[model samples]
Target: MRGEGGTRRIVVIGGGIAGLATAALLARDGHSVDLVEARDAFGGRAGTWEQDGFRFDTGPSWYLMPDVFERFFGLLGTSAAAELDLRQLDPAYRVFFEPDSGPSGGTGSPPAPPSAAHAERDPIDISAQTATNVERFEAVEPGAGRALERYLASARDTYDVALRRFLYTSFTSISPFLHADVVRRAHRLVPLLLGSLERFVARRFREPRLRQILGYPAVFLGSSPDRAPSLYHLMSAMDLTGGVLYPQGGFGHLMDVLVRLARENGVRLHAHTAATEILTETDRGHRGRGRGRRARTTGVRVRDQTPGGGSERVLPADVLVSTADLHHSETTLLPRELQTYPESWWDRRTSGPGGVLVMLGVRGSLPELAHHSLFFTRDWPANFAAIAGGTVPDPASAYVCRPSATDASVAPAGHENLFILVPVPADPGLGHGGTDGGGDPAIESIAEAAIEQVSQWAGVPDLTERIVVRRTVGPADFAEDLGAWRGGILGPAHTLAQSAFFRAGNASKRVAGLYYAGAGTLPGIGLPMCLISAELVQQRLREALR
Candidate 1:
């Protein structure tokens, strides 16, 4: 660890993964760091809840890109394996598409006679190896095995190049990309950047089911594959190669680890504390607007969680990093004049859909369910379209996580932990709670419908009765909990226009000492991106300090 770099006082807003990581990094550099969070607990969206001997992780159940996490821990002079128990999921996840609509028959073999059980149940088990997934793909289309091998080969190259040259680049300036290493790869890079993931996959694969499977990872990027840039195809390669692992407890476990790590690094965390305003002062020499000098951030006005509380104190800081909701932090906490992105600019931006989550503690186990299951309908495109169009898709596809299947600690003996997620449009009005569009009933009604749909899919008609504990969170919760922009669960979509060079930056371009991190900033959303965003902010801070 380094000695005090003049003992800078740095205040970090939001106690999410990004905020915690940034605080820890800054503190490790011998800076005085204080992390303030509005929530009663740390972890922000990755929060967890417990009731009746059941523990449920609220957000981000899947753990992808293990290398990102390993690197983060390594930077702290430890290994993630020593701090946490992470196990690779054998069948990474199970995707159940509409029967016959997906690949059910084996390649070069007679279509397997559908038994009554097989007729009712059909799912492609995705494994860690590309060969295993290719075999499953071959079951649907005769020649798909070879095609997948080829596609993955190309995707691997892109992933490697991106990991080396793109993902870590802060994009704070253009000089980084002007290097000979990046210029040499222009032929491979340009095409990936120019096309959409859907088009790219369709050009390589023929079956609709195969194409959907290949492109589905884009959902994590906050856009349908059709809208996401092909550059994100790297996700498929990363997942297939890096493998999906699960922390012993859940994704929440990682947050707990981060909180402890941050504290160990001398970062103080203030829960239930909200930042109201960013205080700034112009440099003395360039004062009075005579010079076109931007103001520098100095501190934040905060209020503790109290009834009708006003600003309780001004926490002075040499630098401020906000990992809170980008839209809320910029438009609400900072003065309009100080904000580079205006309200109108935010209005013009397209955010990813928020989620309606159902957490159930069932009395009995579901032997048929996998640890991670994705239930898709015949017309998945319609579901995507409905969400993109600002409406909840009727019979929307759902993702179900039964963590109890793998880890007995999350639920009581013989009980199952069911976490179901359905994507809803990120309409600002929707977060206010309503029933205005497409059989869009009240939030509770939607929960009932979603529950019913999942119960049917799980083939447990009595699934509702088996639920000993149940809780639901709609868009309204996202708005209240995370102060998310339009209640978007993820951040901005990875559409061509909203991707790198166009996505939000780590530093406030117009304000000195004001920086940003989290899903909304550079490298975009997901836990891995949040970690990367923290490093990006650290890089910016180091550069400025120097």
Candidate 2:
């Protein structure tokens, strides 16, 4: 299917954010593209669901790194602002800390009786403006404003340097990391990359709350603060200075914009079409010619998922891109002999945490909660440990999103749309702790607990009673729906060893025309990373084609 300019037929598997973006870019570049999704929707993890006059974005609520989205739309000769109607959130979020029983320094002092000294712990409002948040920090702890400014300066530097020199580049080998820009900033970047975020925050701040605020963004990397590299503290700069923005509509609207972009670029997106196996032409078996070259993907064998669907059919292509789950694509779709990473290698890789998402359409509003809220339990460290250890933690730390609080269109009139996410180990065995090993019966109790906790924080004692609509997405759903590797919501963990240059590359080493562009690939996880990954894939494909 080569065209006038020798444009090759490209088959992009999985119509998620990365796939959608990549397909749009490729089609705009003159390739005949077909984007196939397994489910009946285009957005994979970022998919949306609506029921009883309420809508919910199934994944990825917080919109950080807005520049990436801008750049993407800019390349198409338009502005995301024109299309998305973006709005920056002021007082970005609210954080509620579990009341501390022990006195200052954990002196083991006797618990104070109900008195002025034992006041209720007030929730903190983190403003979008850095200076305002710093002031808030200072109010909470004396002299913290100055310390926060210093830390933010360093984070801004790291963010600036990394964005310019590292983020958009492919890192299949050490050559990319050895770039002149990277070398020039080695002194500043090297130490941060080597250090742990926990130590980095602790060294700069004394207050536990301040440390938690600084370290919490690492959760977006799908890792604990202690395990993630201090380099990711750059997220603080993105959140504080760059500002936490959201689409005028919910995230579902953002997805719709992307879909429109792809369609405008002439990408043929097919939902409910599952690619069963990747078709490849063996280069090694061609006697006496190109004997050493890796196998090249010619297309994919796809089958319609609708009822009474017919036999699988071959969709021929010159190049293929799989934006599906990395491990699942490699182990199941591609032939074992043609796989680059071995099963043992995948098994040893540290998978990120899966989350139990409890989405509720409540009958009334939550006045006390902000658009975004984080409830940090007193045992925050233990909570992280439990998730990493593949078990459920009691009184867990969770992130809650109330879109209706900001955009009333997401819910019925006078109602609220609530999304609560609790991180858990991505281990397949961890499903046994819940019901059916899919939606987990334990999720019911977990959701109940979350309602109670949020209700108390909102000063409403009976939040569960007002739940008119409810649903849950657990590890089992991830496995069944997204084909998540170990049911992880975020794909690979951003541990020091598995991050940046060490993350999966966009190009396939074992298959010449095969490429990967998704959260599982380099630049790491998050919507921004997925967008960046698409550009990386396009670059590699162009180089290979040349």
**Compared with the true structure, what per-residue lDDT tens digits does model 2 show for residues 165-284?**
788888656775677877887887888889999888878776666678888888889888889999988888987776688887887788888899999999998888999999988765
Deviating ranges (above 4 Å) for candidate 1: 1-5, 99-121, 284-293, 306-311, 431-441
> RMSD of candidate 2 to the true fold?
3.3
Locate the minimum summed-lDDT window of 10 residues in model 1. Answer: 101-110
- Stretches > 4 Å off in candidate 2: 100-120, 172-181, 284-293, 428-439
lDDT of 1 by residue, 431-526 (tens): 333222222345656677777877777677899888888777778778877899888889888888888888887777566889999999888889
In angstroms, give how far residue 39 of model 2 lies from its true place: 0.6
